[model samples]
Target: MKKLYFVHLLNDYSGSPRVLNQTITALRQQGNDCTLFVGSSGHGVLDELDVATHTFTYKRFDNRWLTLLAYVWSQVALFFALVWRVRPEAVVLVNTMLPFGAALAARLRGAKVVYHVHETSIRPAALKSFLRRVIACCASKVIYVSKYLQVQEGIAGVPAVTVYNGLSEAFQRQAMATAYQPVRKGRFNVLMLASLKAYKGVNEFVALAAALAEDPLLKFTLVLNASQREVDEYFASRSVPCNLEIYPASSNVASFYGDASLVLNLSHVDGWIETFGLTILEAMSFGIPTIVPPVGGPIELVCDGVEGYQIDALNHELLVRTVVRLSKDSQLCQALSERARAKASEFSTANFQKKIVMVFDEL
Candidate 1:
């Protein structure tokens, strides 16, 4: 087995980190020596992983680009030192420009660089230009989570492969704890599961809630992973209906999915569209029918009128109509819920691990 080093922008438990930890586990099982170098402090979630890790002293993911630029500059020497000492056979860089600094350091040491691309949207033309160079020149190989993301990036003639981000075994166990069953009694639950980002259509969801405020039979819940202050700042001016609730993000989200009748993924096209919406499958595994915008990697995951509904976010009428239909019809809800669980199983961790191992073999 080759000695491998993994680099990620954050140690936090989001899409990139979740996929990174799982990749580490799969690599370890094959008897490969591995190490992880995270760009910033994790939200203590990295402690659960068994891999060896070193994190940089850094700034929060925010508007202040200088905070990130300064942190990257500070870690250049340290990252170079680590690469020289370990001399890994391959260094896998995960997500965005966050790990570009370390990738450079690894390349300097003559190690093969593998970049895993989770983001499809790049801003400020200059950043996109730099990414193009990095993919073609620095990386010996590039990995994409979904073909949709690969196509969205619109970069050609690069050594790249697509592997769907898999759901964790821990999550599979949690999914098992609650059977794939839905009871459509009482207030019909409609959940929007996302962090409070403008591109996530936070404002759109609020408008949806208000438009359907008179529907006493339905309730809307925003399951977000932002600080209360941030959440308040975003929604303070909006009028939340009596049936609407804002639930803080938590580790124990499986229970919330269990209680949910329908889930919504309304990420805007202006920002990063879902490059394999991991949460979409998470909800499906619990037999929760979801509503997603007709864009991005989520289109690959959901088949409209089958497993779940996919509507254009700009068309608010369809969003309201679909939700109303699913809530009133218990049979439709159960049918979709059952089919969703089946669809979710196809993208299981075992399937993802096999694809990832194949990529490593090629590398």
Candidate 2:
């Protein structure tokens, strides 16, 4: 069995971290030795895993100097510690930016470095791009979550692979069993599940809600896990339509899928036109149609008039018209939901693990 070490700078339970946890579990089940390194202050989703854990003094921040300094120090300590303890054969780094330090350390200790790309979008800063290009050149292998992301980033050559995100069987079963309930008392239920970040277009959702306020039949709800403080502050600053409700992010995401008539994701800039479309997949698994902007990730997942509609832009008029049409056509909704569920099955966890193991064996 080959020894593999996975390093994650932060341990928050985001999509990337969840995927990391799933990958580690899959690797361990195949009899490979796996270890996880995480930040001392952050909480990891992999606590249940039986792998060895190493803590480092690191933090996630936009401040480049502080972040880099912490990473350098932590990696230095980790390298010496691992040298005398468990000398891994290979190392997988989670994020592109933070992996440079770890990769350098691993190389010094004679270990192969695999860089995983989870950041779908890049900042417009020139310095950031330069740093990323330097790291990309040093990686032995690059893994992208979506092909669209690779193309968008202009990452050519160097043996790159696309591995989409996977959903667990439990999540799939919950989605398949979920039944959509009609709006009571002429109220239409629409949900936006995303973090309260600027790119996620929560403000656009708010604008859409405001535009739909004239219609007594429409009600909106936002299920946000990250940026709770930002969302709360935004809500406190403005007068949202009475029909709109902002729900905090919940672990019981299945219920959120079950309760909504439609799911919405309107990102301003996405790497892949909806690379894996996890939320859209979840909504589809629950047999609900979704609406997304005609941009990255969503375009790839939503089939225009089939599974879902893509807005021309974040225009209120376009979203209002689309939602009205879908809400009125029950047959259309049913057809789309059926097709979406079928599509979601392609990204099951079993299939994901099988593909990953196959790739590892080939390597």
Candidate 3:
């Protein structure tokens, strides 16, 4: 196995950083020397992970132009100071925009580069296009987390491969441990695990809760990364329903799945194109059927009415009816949950590792 260095964009606990952490662990386990370099840290996703990580001076700024300038300046300074010092055979830039500097650093040192793209920026099309072109020009191989994202980026004439994100071992174990149990004929707890971002449909979730508030048999809980007090204040400011509760995001959400009769990932297309629905996959891994939107990658994960329901963002009636049926019918929920568990086998850590290693080998 060839040794490699990685230039990661951020240190947050999003899907991209989680994938990066796993990639380095897998590479190191396969006897390849690996190192990860990040611009800054915040959410502490990479802090506990066992990997060789180093920091650089590329701090993100509130001003968009200042952010770009700082990124460029840090790239040049680190190109000689850090990347050159490491002198690995390859440099893996963890995301597209950050590749502006990492790619040049790799090119100057004559090191192979793999641009791992996890972004699907619809706004600022010009910026996305320029980054795509530059990444295509510099990268030896481009890895996209989903085919939808690959199509969205439009990085034509570049060597690329699509590797769908897979579940961690602990998540898979959660699925394996899930046993179909009969629900009592009473109120059901439906959960929505997502960030408190507009693109993620938190507002839509609140709206849905309000719409379904008349149906007193269903309770909605939103698991997100915010304090209960802040969430309560936000709810107080809005027309939040009495049937809804918002909780902070947790590493251990298997208990949330345990409490939920149905899970949701209702990202709106106009606001956000979900590259891959990590929450939906995690829900499926727990044998909990997902109620996903028909917009982006989540549609690719579930077979409507088989594994889960895919309702359009505009179809309020359909979404409401699906919710009512799932809440009332335990048999249907159990059937879909079983099918979801079966579908999750397609995205396993072992399989993902094999594909990742194959891509590195080919590169």
Candidate 4:
């Protein structure tokens, strides 16, 4: 059996790691020998899987300079360790552009390197350029999560393919079982799941909630991918509206989806373009209509006036109007819900598995 090394910088309960976990499961089911090299930062979805694991010290910091220093140090250490660890003819799969050390080591050790590109909005323009240059020089093949990302970041000569992210079978099964029930009556819940960052539109969501606070029945929920302490610190100076509720990071979001009348991804396009909205897809699986950013990967998933509406996160007036319209119009919401579920079926776990395996095999 051929050896495959999967390297990811952080193993948090985030989109990239979750996608990597699903990919590893698929590859292992096909009888491939898979080994994972991840950071010892926090517990993650990858922990559920039983596999051979190697961890390196890495952690996020509150100070920007400290964080940058730690990240560069981790890469330097990872380069030497990966050079010694990876054997000839083995395939190295780097989860994101941040972990360029794996690609360098793979190229130096005479192994093939494949990158699964997930995000395009990395801070510090020079760092982003450096990582792109690494991909150009070292990667043998590239996999982009969305066509929008491929168009935005595709290298001139590097081979690439676009694979839409998929919902895990377990998540699909749960959504299918829960969505068949009657929609909750009385209160209307507008939900947004994202990291606790300004670019992610946490401020916009809070503003929307404040704008619609006059209607007591309309509620807003924000599930952030951060700890409770982090959430508290982020909101220390800001006043939270009564209708809006905030929650820390969680793996189980089925209950939120089940209770939601509408889902929203309010990413600020200028600051951060959402390459693909995983939370929007999860909402679709639950037969809930979504409001996502007008640009980037979300447009491919949702059609305006169909599965959901695509509106700019900065447009507060339009967002308020849309929320009021969806809250009052029950029939329209039901119609969109059915279409949303159907659109979600096109990007299934089975399809993701088949496409990913084909990419690896061809490489």
Candidate 5:
């Protein structure tokens, strides 16, 4: 059995943590010893994992200076701890580019370091450059979540592989039980599940809701990956339409998918490109059609006219037209749903587990 060490910066109900949760669980089932190093500030999806967890205190702040200081300090602490405790036989798998200290520690102790890259749109151009340099200098192998990410952030000499994200069996079962059904008439719900960030197209979603408010049957739901207090504070100065319902982070998204006629991902390509869209796959598992950004990993999940249309979030007219077209024509919606369900079955957890385990075994 292999001894594996996993490190991630945040433990929020976001994409990276959820992916890490799946990786750790799958690896442990293969009889490998797993250890996790993560932040203790957020109580999220990673909390339920059955493995040895070592947490460090770290919190994010609005001020860039304070956030940078906290991040640097966490890495310093992690470096010392790992240097003292890590065995030479262990392989350290850093989840994102943020936890470079793990790579450094592993290299110092003669352990191998693998980078599972998921994002390319890191803020502050200088930091992004520095992180890539760290990966080039320290990582022995690189695993990218999507083909697009591999091309965007790949280093020239590093060995790289692409592994698409997969949906959990529980998620598939829940979707099948709750959402696989005939389309309802008279009420159409358009859903967008994302974090409460401006670049996530929160304003665009609200605008779309307002534009369609005259139609009594049309409604919009925005689920943010944040606490209730954060949700309230974010919309304090903004105007929310009557047809739009904004909610905080939720663990149970099957209910929303069940009620949804269509789902969307409106992240801006320039500000924050989506590395891999797990929510799009989740919606597809429910046979729910989606509209996602035209660029990045989301394009891989959704073909322009096959499963769903690819449109830029900044194009307000196109967004409205697509939503209206889907709303008015049930035949088109059903066709897309059928194709979407078929497409979703191609990304299975069993396949993902087998392939990812093979990578670990080879390492």
Candidate 6:
């Protein structure tokens, strides 16, 4: 069996780390030796995985110059450490910038390097273009999470593949259970679970809520992972129409999905149509219909009017009208819920792991 080393700078419970954890667990279950190289925040998720993990004392710096220098030093040190110790056949660099220092180091040691692109790099226009060209040319393989991202980068005629993010089997089971519950008495509950960032369209969701406030049938819950200060500032500036509650990030996310009638996502600028809309998928798994803007990852998951309807734009009037129509149509809601669950099953862990193992075998 080939030994694979995965590297990441942080170990937070975000999309990238979650995907890494799923990949490592899946790889180990198939009898491959996998090692995860992580920074200080390593102990939480990685400790539970079947694979081995190595933690380094790489401090995260906020100062621009110091951060760049420290990251370079850490990569160089880590590369040599891996070569002298684990000596893996291949290295998978999760998310890093510049010359993709980890990949370059692995190449020097005659080990194949794979670069997993999770987000668009931040650099001056000329430098960013140059970096993309170099990465496209030198890396042994490139894995993109979404087709929308691939097209945006214009990565043509290269050793590239699209592997979507997958949910765990447990999450799938939870979704199924959520879908089977009988409807309870209450106003229609709409949920928007996203970081309260500008680009994520939290403001648009609020606007939509305001437009529908006079309607006695609608209510909203805005779940955000932001500092209390930031959350207060956001609420102070905006006026919402319906009964609104701002919740801090909580572990009981599935419970929230279980209680909601619909999930809404309206991102303005997404990297790759969202390789996968995890929130929407989870909501669907629970048998709740979703509403999303007509762009990016949601379009791929939600079959407009079948699984859920897509808003033409973020206009408050349009959003209000759509919500009113769905709230009034019980048959449409049930049909959409059924279709959403079916769509979610296609990305189940079984299918995801099967495809991921195939990729490893080809390598």
Best by lDDT: 4
Which of the two, 1 or 4, has more lDDT? 4
Error of 1 at 128 (Å): 2.6
lDDT of 6 by residue, 1-363 (tens): 778888777665455666777878788888877887787632344555766777654665547667767656776666666666534466555453342555655766777766677656354466567657757665766777667666666456557777776788887778777653323465788888886666777788777777777877788888875546668877786676547777865545788887887788876644223445668878888888888767765677887888887874456677777778877877788888888888878788887788777777777
Identify the runs in model 4 with alpha carbons over 4 angstroms from their true place. Answer: 180-185
lDDT for 314 (candidate 5): 95
Q: Residue-wise lDDT of candidate 2 within 69-156, one digit each (tens)?
A: 6766766765565555434466555454554556666656766666677664544465457646745565666677767766765455
Q: For residues 126-185, could you state the per-residue lDDT of candidate 1 as single tens digits?
A: 767875776676777788888897776745766778888888898887885776444445
TM-score of each: 0.92, 0.86, 0.89, 0.98, 0.97, 0.83
The predicted structure with the larger lDDT, 2 or 3, is 3
Better of 5 and 6 by TM-score: 5
* Reference-based lDDT, residue 358, model 2: 63
Quote the positional error of residue 149 for candidate 4 in Å. 0.9
Clash counts for the predictions, in order: 0, 6, 1, 0, 0, 3
Q: What are the Cα lDDT values of the candidates?
A: 0.76, 0.70, 0.75, 0.90, 0.88, 0.70
lDDT of 3 by residue, 1-363 (tens): 676877775676567777877777777788987777777535446676776777777776657788867766777765665546545465555554564666767776777778877766633677666666767677888888888877877466788889988877876887678774425346677789876666777887787788899987888989886545656665676776899987874666777777777888877777777778877887887788888887677878987888998876556777778888888888888899899888878899998888888888787
Pairs clashing in candidate 1?
none
Residue pairs whose backbone atoms clash in candidate 5: none
RMSD to the true structure for each prediction, in A, is: 2.3, 3.1, 2.8, 1.2, 1.3, 3.6
Native-vs-model 5 lDDT?
Answer: 0.88
Winner on lDDT (2 vs 5): 5
True-vs-predicted CA distance for residue 217, candidate 2, Å: 2.7
Name the weakest run of 10 consecutive residues (lDDT summed) in model 1. Answer: 88-97
User: Which is superior by TM-score, 4 or 6?
Assistant: 4
Instruction: Locate the minimum summed-lDDT window of 10 residues in model 4.
Output: 177-186
